[model samples]
Target chain A: MRFLLLVIGILYITPVLALSPPTGRVLLTLTGSITETNAGHTAKLDRKMLNALPRYSITTKNPWVHQAHKYSGFSAVDLLKLTGGKGDLLRITALNKYVIEIPITDFTKRGAIFAMRKDSHPMSVRELGPILVMYPFDDDPKLKNETYYWRSIWQISTIEVLTSPSKE
Target chain B: MVKWFRKWLPTSKLQHWYVYGLLSLIVTITLLASSILLYSYNGNQATKQRIYEDSLWNALQFQLQSYRFLNYLVQIDKKDLPLNGAAYTQYDLLMSRVDLLRSGEVGYLIRGLTGGRTVRLLNIITGELELISLNLSKIEEGDLSYLQDMTTRLKQLDNQVNEFTILVSKGTNLYIARQRRALGENLENVRILMMCFLASLFVLCCCIAKGFSVFKINQRNNKQLLIDIQNIHEEKAKILTLVAQEARPQIQALLGVPCDNTESSNSIKESANELLHTINMFTDLALIDIKKLSLDITTESLQKNLDDYVQIFSSKLQRKGVTLVSYIDPALPDVIGLDFKRLKEIILELLLNAIKHTPEGSISINVRPSSLTPTQQPLNLENRRIGILQIAIKDTGFGLEHAIQDTLRASPTTQDNQPLILQNNIGLGLSLCYRLVHLMRGEIHFSSEATSGTEFWVDIPYEVSQSSPENISLYSCPDPKRALIFTTDNHLANALRLQLSSFNIEANRYLEGPYYDDEDLDLVIIMDSNLISPEIESNIKQWQKNGTFVLYDHQLTKDVQNKAYAAKAQSLSFPLTQSRLNGLIMDAFKTD
Candidate 1:
């Protein structure tokens, strides 16, 4: 009976461990001071891997939108937990070479998200999609100014954690 | 200018003007306060509107930026560049900003500015965003053909958003300008209200000052008037004192004379007494003029007083050959509230006028109870009996001329014309008579015909006195006496002889030039003498020594009466009464 109980426990724990290894092409990369990784010293995530980290949906207006649209993603804090990323500042880079520096505290405080889908659909490259860094601008009045809006990077490619303060 | 102002200015009417001004001030203040409150409320609403408009403008700016970014993404995709996830994210962001602008405070402000134009723009933008979003999936799959169509639609929306933003900005500026102008007008109204309040205060001060000045002037005038009245009173008192002091001696001498029954002697005495009474009435002229002569009303015989007054003119009437007729109503009260002295003067004045004017016709006086003249009756006597005693004096003489009659009826204040009326010798006595009648609350009427006569009727109000008349009979001498009389005047000597004969006393008259001794004389009578010579005085003494009684008529000065009394003779005044003569005869006979 102890053997049967051990098998059931293994069945429940297997799927969770299986979700940590990315099978599709890597869309997001996390580097520096990381404990968990899908490959080597850095943590790299595909769409399916990022989705497996606690999903949430939000509707908000931003500087780039004509109407409020629904964005489905995992919170930045959840993604950091999945990669075991530890840092005071995050340097994010988009595919178009657009870069922004954000405090790591903003991830938890402002409900910052790594958006994978807009209006319930997966984002394409031409749509500034695949991954986007978004803050809930409409929900929080303090995040509505230019500082937070500029920090919300679109078409994000990589996140580098740094313990040092940014020059800007 | 001063006279015109005096005529037109509301001098004593300031209170009414002040009340009206105060009421208007209160109403104006209330109106101004209410206007200020309403203006402040309007200003608050304007501020709220401006805040809403500013929020709407910020929303439009955001929507424009989102649309521009979407267009940039589409351009990048058409250039065969890797957009990554930019196109879909930009499209979603543009849609979200457009959705926010369509509702909430921004929506409300846009709707207020262009009615439904903003909503229509929003609908068009929304429809364009939905179409672009649908094609977003196709473009992501490496399909670059839809990029041009999406860019064209986004460019159109950008143009429309820019136009709507300008419209909203212009509309907001105009609204702000209108609000500013309204606030300025409200301030101007407040300034006008302040000026009006100051003006009202100025007018109220002027009215109060004017009223105070008028009150001061009235007080000064009243003080001056009081001083003038006091001076007039002092002057009147002095004149009355002079008249009373000068006329007292003559009046006392005349009152001492005894009255006799003989017509000629009685008329002489009556005329003298009337002259004294006239002077006494003249002394009281000031009192009568001021209406201060109160009646000393008492029970007295009006008929008897009238008879005495009538007798004063009898000798003149006799000499003028005018017949005298008199009548008295027996039913009239024997005693009534008559100021006897004033009434006697009134009768005497009328009688003298009649005697002076008549040539040969008869003069008559009639007394009776009669109705008061229409003007003389008091208004409040509806339930009470008002007794009026009418004394009418009718004379057949050259009637009073029209002008003289007018002067008689004229008010006494017209003293300048009084002397003119008296120039005819008729109005002086009648004027005096008229004043006396009026003083007694009486009315006098005169009727005349040019060639015939004039008549005066005086009606006086009286209260009947509750007293009976006294009856007194004349006394006669018990024995006839042989008496000697001495006088300087023939009329007086003859009057004395006639009066002696009525008492059956045989008397012989001696003129002033003679002296005689009679052994059979029982009494000696001296009529009147200012001074007696030593010879006449000795003769009076010799008659006293011969057991004869002497009686002297003292009509001269007080010194002459002292001399007569020093001679040890009984002296009597002129015009002796029957009772006095009877008493004298009884004393003389008792000595015998």
Candidate 2:
């Protein structure tokens, strides 16, 4: 009876220790202060894994388009939850090596999202896709300001959660 | 070809008005054409400017829409709304805006302004929107991390697009400025063209005014010329009438007497005839010179006329003791185109010159077909086959003096320089002859030596006529009869005796007394019937009853005329011609 209980405990803890690796080509990677990861010290995700997060749809205008467009993707809060990341700031990188930093509250309080599909279609790299950051500028008029507009990143390849300098 | 061209050209009389009207029409047409061209050019430029401005405005609208849509998308992302059909619709609308900005005329304008960078910006924006659209599923699942990054890139794109819009506005404004400058230049050109047209019009008006003045002057001159010509014609006609009517009759009277029996009488008669012929020739020449008369050309016997002329002057030659010789070619045509009156004057002039100059020598006149040297022939008569009758009159006398020859060689305009004696003699005669010959299309040449002789030759063209001509000569008295003349004038009695002797008639003259006692007389001629008394008249009647015919002169009293008529006598007028005297004598003898 003792052996069976130990076996059940090990089985329950093994999943927490070893996360399932990405089944397809990795589309995004999260590092630094991330608790849940499929690779060591980092969380690697494919298109399928990214789709498994809590979904959101944003209908808003951006500097790149003339009208409001519907963007379907996971909220940054849910993506953070999936990676088990805790940070005061988040640094994002694009495929072109372009980088930008944003406050963690922009994702948690503002409900910003990483869009993977536009108009119900998956975006290609040529479309600045696989990932794009979109603020809910239509819902919160404050997000339509320049500060929030600059925070919205496109063609995202990686994210790094970092603690505040004071906390370090 | 010249005549055809002249037919289309305006005559001198109408040229002024025609040229003025043509110049005015040309100026007006040029003005109209220039105005039309200016208007069309301005209209085309305006159209082109409008097109450029329209394209600029379109580009501006597209850029504005792009910014607005971008703002909307930011709001939607911030709200974290569900991916819905409305959002996709907005996205599509934004994409279409970018597409419009990248192509067509708007694209070209933007590209020109941005150095081709505007297209790249547009492409970037489109790519970003498409990427966002492709990642819609991930974005809808609460993955909002990429929003900040996309917003920053889009902000940069928006800045670039805004710059493109500014460039477009500036380019359109610059185009408008350039077009305005071009328009001003066009207006200036129109002003200059208008000024040129006005100046041309002014010049044309001046020309027309000058032309009118010239035309008026010409008309005045023409009127004056016509009046002058009319005066000349009247004067020529008057002179011609005087010679024909008065002088000719008087000269005929002088030539009526038979003066061959005495040298002095013969010389006096020849001098009177020569003077009369010279006067007639001078008057005719004056008429011809003024173009008031034409030579009356006719087919006549030149030889016959020449013979008559020589015969009339034969006694003058005899008195001068000069032998006269003449020749006529048999090969010459029977009749030729000759102005008989003019030819007579020319021949007589030559003969008189010959007789006057040849004091103690001979004169020879010859007529024949001329083999003229090329230099002697008139150019116009070169190809003609008609007979060239050359008449040459040569005289053995004092040849022309050097001074006289020089005077003759001088032009008629310089005739005043000639000595008065020469001008009154040979100068006047030769000039007259020259003019007359030229009028007949003939040429005359002369050669002379001092104290030797002078020879004159004339070559005249003549047309042959088909008809034969009759010969002209003096009439001869048939028979001679005895007559007694009673005249108070001694000179008249002597002239009558001399005239009667030439006809083979015997005449007894009594100037101061009259006797009708001659029984052998066939006729008695009384010079004046008034001189006869009743006793004499009775005696004449007794004589007439004894078969003697009586003749009375003119200027008789009516009673005397009746007495003479009753006595069966005839009356003769004074100053009788030779033919008239011969006719009277023949009539009287026939009656006897």
Candidate 3:
């Protein structure tokens, strides 16, 4: 009984530390180039060019989804510019070794983005943060299927704009 | 008054106030806690919901940014460069941030970032991304309508998010208002309950105050009653003292002149007779009150004590022309408290008055002794012998006025129906006699006329008993002719010797001393013996055993009486009057 009470006391006080915002470290590493699709063309952007664009969010549902969830991210075109990429097709690889190809023109879609954070915090590797492709499946039922959901890669390690696209 | 009652209330009530205060504190604490909890919960829920909405918003924004970047990549065609360079690395990091937002990694940042319209915009952006990812390489130049259509959808989505946010804000305001009203009602109920408890407590205090006031008033009234009783006692004491002081001297004067002077018997007798006349006058006044008085029957001793009263009065009555004749019935015992002496004096005074008034008639007093006749049959043996004494006094003189005669007849009917008609006018003398008789536990009756005098009768009841002869000695006499002479005064002894000369007594006298020898003493007459010695008494006893007659003075000590009885001597008290002396000598000789 005494031990149980002690456990409850600790549990009751644990939220104080857990509920506070994380401080001190901001960790994100990207080692490959990115591409942008803007005004029906593939374009390359530097970090300064990407930084100059207004920061914003779009909260909505999507349709090419499996496990439907609300998603938040920057547009893929914007990220590619920031990474200095200019190619017709972008090759992306997840830390889990999954790969996908996206055409540069696809990045210019209205609800599409290359997101870096969710709810103001970096995502864990298992949570598919630091690099991932996502769609708001909760907003569009059409996106909550295997086709669209599979293309949204998580644990991404690299994105390279390639001209010699054998598969594409 | 309310304040005073509050003072009397128990400390418990004060403690109750503190309890109420504590309850108020608890309620306030609860309200504060509830308000804080409501604020926190609303904040938490709003933050969570906003995060979900804003995540969609941010994901859409990221999609827009990523699309532009991808377009730039295609336009620039810089695929050969490493993104790790300062400019490229920064762009890669920005791309990573966009990826994290799309994956919902910074979900908390989405709070306040987007709403319903933004959520739709996110859907449009995600759809566009999906379409481009799949079919951008397949689109011909004429498919430009697709990009235009996607842009139109994105703008519509943004508008929808705004509409949703407005609806949520209106809902939050309603929730807050309802919560505030609930809190207010809870506080109001607690306040009302506290006030009711205090009011009831105050009423209880009032009851206690009323009870205490009643007790205090009763105590005050009791104290006043005690004071009143004390005052009444003091007043009675004063009245008694006044009565004693005013009446004692007068009553004492009525008792008589002192009998201390013994010069001549005649002179003494004459003085006594004079005192009797004054008593007679007092008795006359007492009777005058009776003649006109209306009162119930009263006892004689209560009127005045007469055993010691008449001797002094009778002497005075003898000097007057009237001779007081008395015919007393020896059978009646004295139970009536009529002062016998006082009654006699009053009667003698009446006789004198009758003698003076008529100048030549006799006043004969005949008293018929009364006895109890059982009105109901004898209830007990003791009551069968109960006796009564009645007395009547009749006078011969010039008779009564007719008016007085009628009044006498109307004197009030007796239970026995005895007629009493007055023969003379009602005067001080007649009235006095009537009252005196009435005082004897008896009623008065008169029979009179203008020519013949009046007669008065009194009735009383008493237990009559015989004078037992226990005082007479029963002794064996060898000679039956002895005479006994008893005298205590020396002068009386000489007179007794002369008085006994005619009798053949062996005359012996002892002087008042212990020197006399008792050896030859027989037929002993103790005259003037004082301090009789035991040796003399022993010798007298020897003689008495040899059949000598023994008599003693009244002054003999009680020890002598015991001694005489031990010796079987006949003892009697001494100094008999002339008539009694002669009678005693004759009885003694006859007994011998």
- Residue A95 of candidate 2: its Cα lDDT? 58
lDDT by residue (B1-592, candidate 3, tens digit) is: 9999888554643344444445555665565556555556555554444434444443444545454444443433234333233223323433443444434423323222334443454445445544543333322222333444444444554444344335334434444466557556755655565565555455555545654665577678879987885576456545544655565566556445565545465565564455455554443443333232232322332112322332333433334423233433323332332234445655555554445554433345444445545243211225334344554545556665567767766775432211132234455455555554544344555677556566655554333323331211222223434333333333334444543443434453554455444344446665334534566666666667766666654444454656653455444432132234345555544564
DockQ of each candidate relative to the true complex: 0.02, 0.01, 0.02
> lDDT scores for all predictions?
0.66, 0.68, 0.47
* Docking class for candidate 2: incorrect
Q: B436-467 in candidate 2: lDDT tens per residue?
A: 77767677778888665888898877655545
Kindly list the per-residue Cα lDDT of model 2 for residues A1-168, writing each as its tens digit. 999999998886654534578998788999888788777678889988888987888888765555678998987677777877788788999754568988777777897888999988998654557788898887887775557755777668899989878778
Cα RMSD, each candidate: 28.2, 32.1, 34.7
- List residue ranges in candidate 2 displaced over 4 A: A1-168, B1-155, B181-185, B188-192, B195-199, B202-206, B213-217, B236-282, B289-291, B302-333, B342-592
Candidate 2 chain B worst ten-residue window by lDDT: B413-422
Ranking by TM-score: 2, 1, 3
CA RMSD (A), model 3: 34.7
| DockQ agreement of candidate 2 with the native complex | 0.01
Residue B54's lDDT within candidate 1 is 52
lDDT of 1 by residue, B321-358 (tens): 55454555555766666678778778777877777777
| Each candidate: chain B TM-score | 0.39, 0.38, 0.28
